[model samples]
Target: MDMGGLQIEQDGQTLRILLSGVWGLPSAAGLDRRIAAIHAGGVRHAVIDTSGLERLDTAGAVLLHRLWRRLAAQGAKVEWPAPRPEYRTLFDYVADSGEGKVIRPPKESGALALVAWVGWLTLFFLREARRFIAFIGRVAESAAKVALQPRRLRLTSMVHHMEEAGLRAIPIVGLLSFLIGVVMAYQGADQLRRFGAEIFVVDLIGISVLRELGVLLTAILIAGRSGSAFTAQIGTMKVNEEIAAMRILGLDPVEILVLPRMFALILTMPLLTFYADIMGLFGGAIMAWSSLNIDLNLFAQRLQDAVSLKTFFVGLVKAPVFAALIGMVGCYEGLRVKQDAASVGRLTTRSVVQSIFLVIVVDALFSIMFSIMGI
Candidate 1:
């Protein structure tokens, strides 16, 4: 305990101590005796001179803190004198944990760790994106080739999918879009009623539906439905060796297999988007009649003024790009499926997720372009 040989002295009845080095328990009795002697001599001011001290462990630091706190409770003022700059780290360590082992300042490591982590993520995403892009290229090429030779495109299968994609999907899309429009109108009316601006609810629903919500919702739904279906279909073909057989027969599988599905989705998405816009407007009309005491005909008239033909066209413009993204992802996933049932499902899922992400990204790009053109 007294390994550092603690010494207590007095100057004008003030207690002062010089810490020679590191101290510990074996000398606890001697240190206690020194403290007692200093207190008995009526020295209430104490200073710990640590300049000559070399090292102190957690236990030593704890002992010092307890003694300092104990003396202060008894009204003795305590002070610790300056030591080597190296001790600054030790003090900071003590400050943090009160484990009290004063440690030296730590050396700074270069920013390599942060940079390395970011680099790893960047590389991983880049690789995934490259693979997706390559798949899209193949899909587009196959689609174009088959399109050029109408004989290769299967009209029957194309028509079947168009019905499945466009007609079958209508009810769900319409229901969801209608509910969204009603909810938005109600919320807007509730807020706008404070300022007698309830009529503006018509403008909000009309403009928002025509420009953004209708297109975005339709894209998300198709991405989940058609995108996954494409991957699964293509994946099934791969597993069944149909794709391989077509290739072996010197036939471009892209034309016979992938192109029809791609074109079918592209042709159908815009029609669905337009349909959704009408359903949404009808929904808002219902909300206006129920909550705002506005007549359905009046609501329709207000919506017509706000949602012009140009607004509808801008939304229509987004549909083709969104549809193309969804189709491309679906076909690309279908093509990349390894020859296994499990691989087919996994690729299908990946394709749907990627397609949705790309759809949002492209939608944002369209929004920016429209803003730049002041449209």
Candidate 2:
């Protein structure tokens, strides 16, 4: 007997097949050719001898089962004679399990199925919205409780989160804002130079950064950084049953965990926006001096005459609202995590995406409001 090789002998109306050696995945290659050869032999009956089989795994059993089935289907009788216990067990298991089973075709779906899917999604969205509103209400109630009883507030935890989310983020925020300012100044300089209005690059950079880009970009970065971190941290706690334990101990997880993050972001975001504005202006000044050949003093004087304090206030005003949205979405998604590792990853990603989306939407709303008010 050869490894993974079959020997066939024909005697009158009977056929004898000998299977030998290893017949697992690695050795089962070319098995289809052997099965085809047997099928083309025109034998009416066959005996599968497994006595020479040195090693037989599930794959070998499946191949053997398929050969037996094909022979049986072709009006040939197939028998296994005195198989070893292990071989008999493997063969019988594979045969009973119906490996290489026939596949049923999928049922066709029409307009009714499409309508059902749409209805299901709409209901799911409504249910999620209800839960989110309830979560927001709980967060607000917790904040009110903290406000009334200052002792219940976790000052140390709040400070720690503020440092983590706000202080640590300053370097990146400043760098990105600086680069954006430089790019804006460069582009504005080039365009305005065509009309001999290079000095107005200062106004372009100051007004754009202060009124919109600085705060919006800073919020987006925070959503991806701190927002994702909040979701992952809380989601991990949920997975570990720590949140449930807090409830068992009569402690509010929202008050203890979520409140501190929300408050810290609310307090720190405006400060970060201010810092971003200054850095962006500084970067724009440098680019103005170098690229547009506008003196730093001239750029400053032009900025003073063109951009007002109201423009700066308008950008900083959006910071706290964006921060609250980011915090709520992050904590909400975190708390929604199921008791699984995959759920933590999925919810964390959702938190970042949802937070960023809400921040942009709120920014747009503010823009519309300010436009209406003629700011």
Candidate 3:
């Protein structure tokens, strides 16, 4: 039915409205109210029949847009036909979904979007990794030059590192390992004694200590001790501009600073682990002898029999890798410092954390790889 130059028709779920006379604020305002009423009545879907619209203006366009928005927001479906040339120009400012217009897409790019996002992330990760690799390569090259010309990496630094990683760590590593052994021995004894298999405590302590605990305990100790020390020393040097001074003097800081630490760490970590294994074994022996009444000689024999050179060497080999990783991480963090004391401290802590985390991750990788190799 026609009502004041506007035609309105309701067909089931659709309410079609048409504008005829010169469109203005009056037409838009009336439709806004009517759309609100329709929404209130839960008439969710409708078509606007603009077939009769003539001489539409800004107000006419705003009125149509307002109804379109209200219908959309109320979960009402609305389809307005391709506007007549006269009316279409008025709604040209409409963009995006909130314009209260129904747009049917010819195609969707959801899959393509996901692929692009994932590809970007992958490239980002690879770029970061490549940067790290490049950094390592530069450090190594600088170190090689220093080694060739300056004659660094002498016995003194190596000896000192051995003293620190091995001799200095011995007491704590030994004590901890011994205690771990003792606990293992007691636990094994309590259960094994029932089956007259108390001797297996020796095997348990030997295998566990040699293969896993010794390496792990040693790594944790060094991470706490040497890892932090590496970071702090390099960080302090960095903060003091000593590293920059070396660079100015044409001295490769990596060789003078980092290479020594690398040598020291690689030199001592295995020794520390070896010492730890011994200590853990001794502790286990003590527990076995005291709690299980197992013969010390028998425990030693069982330990020797149960722990193979292969297993012992495995832990030994892993220690150098752990040390290298720790040193790398520590040096990386230290180098990142921009001379701030707070940043130095923060970087030191991060170095230790990252070192320990990488040690575990590398350990897991080693375990999996070795298992595959039947090690």
lDDT tens digits, residue span 1-375, model 2 = 456878888888888888878887876768866786666256788888888888888999888888788778777788888888998899889878868879677865888789999999999979988998999999999999999999999999999999999999999999999999999999998899999988888889999999999999999999999999999999999999999999999999999999999999999999999999999999999999898788888988899999999999999999999999999999999998999999999999989888988888888899899999999
Candidate number with the higher TM-score (1 or 3): 1
**What is the lDDT for 309 in model 1?**
89
Model 1 accuracy (lDDT, Cα): 0.80
Candidate 3: worst-modelled 10 consecutive residues by lDDT? 92-101
Instruction: Tell me how far the alpha carbon of residue 268 in candidate 1 is from the true structure, in angstroms, after superposition.
Output: 0.7
TM-score of each candidate structure, all chains considered together: 0.68, 0.73, 0.64
When 1 and 3 are scored with lDDT, the better candidate is 1
lDDT of 3 by residue, 188-282 (tens): 88999899987787888888888999999899889888888888888898999999999999977777777777778887888788888888888
List ranges where model 2 is wrong by over 4 Å.
1-71, 74-124
Clash pairs, model 2 backbone = none
- Highest lDDT: give the candidate number: 2
Q: Measured by TM-score, how close is model 1 to the native structure?
A: 0.68
Task: List lDDT for all candidates, in order.
Answer: 0.80, 0.90, 0.78
Q: What residue runs in model 1 are displaced by over 4 Å at the alpha carbon?
A: 1-114
